[model samples]
Target: MTDPSQTPSLDLPDGVAVTGALKPGYEQILSRQALELIATLHRELEPRRQERLAARQEVVRAIADGEDLDFLPETASIREDDSWRVAEHAPGLVDRRVEMTGPTDRKMTINAMNSGARVWLADQEDANTPLWENVVEGPMNLRDAIAGTISFTSPEGKEYALKTTDQAQLPTIVMRPRGWHLDEKHITVDGERTSGGLVDFALSMCASATLQLEAGKGPYFYLPKMEHYLEARLWNDAFTIAQDALGIPRGTIRATCLIETYPAAFQMEEILYELREHSAGLNAGRWDYLFSIIKTYRTRGRDFVLPDRNAVTMTAPMMRAYTNLLVRTCHKRGAHAIGGMAAFIPSKDEEVNKAAFEKVTADKQREAEDGFDGSWVAHPGMVQTCLDVFDRVLGDRPNQVDNTREDVQVTAADLLDVKATPGEVTEQGLRANIDVGLQYLATWLTGRGAVGIHNLMEDAATAEISRSQVWQWINNDITLTDTGEVVTQELVERLVDEVVTTLPGDASNYEEAKRLFLAVAVADEYADFLTVPAYEEMP
Candidate 1:
């Protein structure tokens, strides 16, 4: 006998009072229904929830076990001023050239060593010959092919020179791995393997050959098909071991990693960060990445076969997402962001070639606009075009203005007045105003201590317009020069004195400002001019 007050009571609305438990028949029905609903939900969601939980756990484990994570060996830190070190050894920097040596508009094979590509890749994996033939012809045949006498019979029985006069202008060759050789432990000899035991041997061969080739001219390598951080780590380890064996410095070898797989996309930032000290840059491998995704994720029972390679376009959202991520990731890490390679343009027809060139030019322009510093061209004929596009897009301009200068207000009306017709404003007045504004922009961008100015305007064409105007003024020197050369410090001082003697309205201060601005702008622009061999000796 419990007291009624001691029992807990449910407070209910007037109409909804307490009731006894349901009858057995109704209770059994409700219990069965509830159990069925719960079972249905568990069947629907258990696998998915478990998958998510497992993935989350994997990430947590990876972070928690950081010591086990593969990382590049510690190397010497690169100074801010040393950013351009790779440029020194780059053959592209010297000749502004890259040549494609391959079968070329026909069924043929090519080697990286003889192609004179600053970076050569052995075409072992993709060559038509059997594994043994590729291995034998790999470097040896490439040497003979580079020499003057090699020739091959076309499928139609027409004779063609293997070593064309065009090869003379080619620069740097890069070797690519052939066959099913990811590393020493995974060698697909005769299209079969026993224990995946020789993968290290294959990787070592690649690392050794790459280092040997890089020893003389350009110290560079292009690492392809990197699927995981451990893959990259393995290569770096092999590189380290090879460098020690060859007496080369640990970080002397510069390499570019190809992001050609889905997993590699997510790990790009981590990979770049891991190999920051050793990596030259990362490239988007659109075709191979697509192939990998389809092969890895597509259900075996489904009819998900991809179309022909030529029919495929790099328009997939995933491809663009990966590229955007790579660009953002590289720039954030202070590394160069190289856009993906353009498709090899066919045909020597002038109209056909020009059209192809224009397409590539447009592609490179878009990349430059998106903040990529450079890209790859398969044909040597496209090299100059690529450089010209980059030059026009990345025109030399000054940095952003500091807060101190941002407050310096110029009325819109005054800006319009600077461009007044010849009769409306004197040449001196127009020149002085333009000189002042340009100087302010340049000084702010370059941090007075900096030498060159990088144009930051969104419209590259408009920046070029401004650059042309400034160069014209310096070249003509109608106002402040007696000789043809730029107006010197002494000439500027004399002009200021003369102007003070004649004109008014802050004339002295304005002249002094104009002189300072013009001098620095000229120096900055002149440095860029020196980069062009023809302009090196220009007055």
Candidate 2:
């Protein structure tokens, strides 16, 4: 065992040592000040706290006395690991390779049978289909598409034929059921009997072996509009029922839930935990979540309105806060946190498109920095860009291992302490080490094929590797020198050229536009660093 008192003193940078010497006195003063502030707050909050406690007690008493209450089932039970049995028999779900959303959004269907993505989900919710038409023909038309007539458009604009009619060939294509309604008895949709509720219909459509025999692989489902843990549990229960009814194992069917609400953000851990055994992974639903936040918070009052559609900005702090929380939460639970959608492509004008692409590349870099494994793009035109970004950010590093600092200890005394606890003393040294390390890694990986830099604090070797890589990038001209120079258009352009376009495209124009946008956004994101002008020059 290590001796706490005899702990080897950490060799801190000079500024940290100076601050460490001055911390105790400042800590003493801060403690007194905090105590007085807390007392003042306590006096103000005591009455409201007492009233809330009393109200909660009354509700508890009412429940104990058996007063009727319409309680939703608790999510905790479904969160247990053993709640669902994994399917022993593999379902014959066909891989309907291509997914297409029409301009009007009404005629979504799958094509390129047995090709690219493992499963294809025909997007209906965000499509241009009229609600009534969707209620009537959405599922039926999709069913027909699955049964036959599916085709794909090749890059050369020629139509490639699909073998969708070969029921024995392709994976199952999943569709959202229309007019679904839930009640006491059997759930009903479009005058047909659905096994349970919305969830039951979904699982049955995706998990039945007999269905798999007809469809090839059993169909898969995408659960959207998820808001809470209980919502996930409800879906789990439906899946359980469907699996049992079809004599399949409990967790046979797979599903992906869209995280699209603020409440969903808070409940992400519980939701992922509840669906872990059956989930495909979580998709970041950017537009829907934004709409939900506006509705939930009623943000229209302050003239702080978002651009209607075309001119909207995705770099708002709130947006970053939500997505960052998502990345952290998903990694915490060992589940994939897919990045947000970047459905828009840069314009055809080479300069404009290149600039747009550059901005997107930078945005994706930020997402990669925050810990997303992959992102979504609407067009095949954007696939090369997506792959380029992923390759640059993901590099040759092994799959990301969870190194989150959940176990890091923080205390009131530590917060107030002026002297470093032989750990970290000066804020500048800590900041410099982090900045230097990250910048170095970013530089080194600039033109490289896939690379990964593990958390240095978690693995001792990672620190040495980081130091080595940083120097390598510096030497190779892959990374910017740490001479602390102000970032200029030339620097941004160089970084873009080095990192953004690994694909075939005349992207110069797009690159320029993206660079301008990124300059503004990055400056805002790192205002403190940008303001110091000198820091820009720091190596």
Best by TM-score: 2
**Model 1 agreement with the true structure over 1-539: per-residue lDDT tens digits:** 65655544333322222122222222222233222322332333334434532453364345335422122233223212233322122333222223232311122333232333433333332211122223323334444333334456777997655344344344444434421122111122222221111121232233333434433433445565555565566456545654564456666665567776545665665555556556666767655565444323322211222332233344433444556666665655555566656544446567866777777788777666666666665444555666677677665521000111222232222211211212211234334434333433233222121111122111111122232334334333434322334433344445444534443344544443344344533443322211122111112
Per-residue error at 202 for model 2, in Å? 4.5
lDDT of each: 0.40, 0.41
C-alpha lDDT of candidate 1 relative to the true structure: 0.40
Give the Cα RMSD of candidate 1: 29.5
User: Which candidate leads in lDDT?
Assistant: 2
Worst 10 residues of 2 by lDDT: 454-463
Q: Please estimate how well model 2 matches the true structure, expressed as its whole-model Cα lDDT.
A: 0.41
**TM-score of each model, in listed order:** 0.44, 0.47
By TM-score, how accurate is candidate 2?
Answer: 0.47
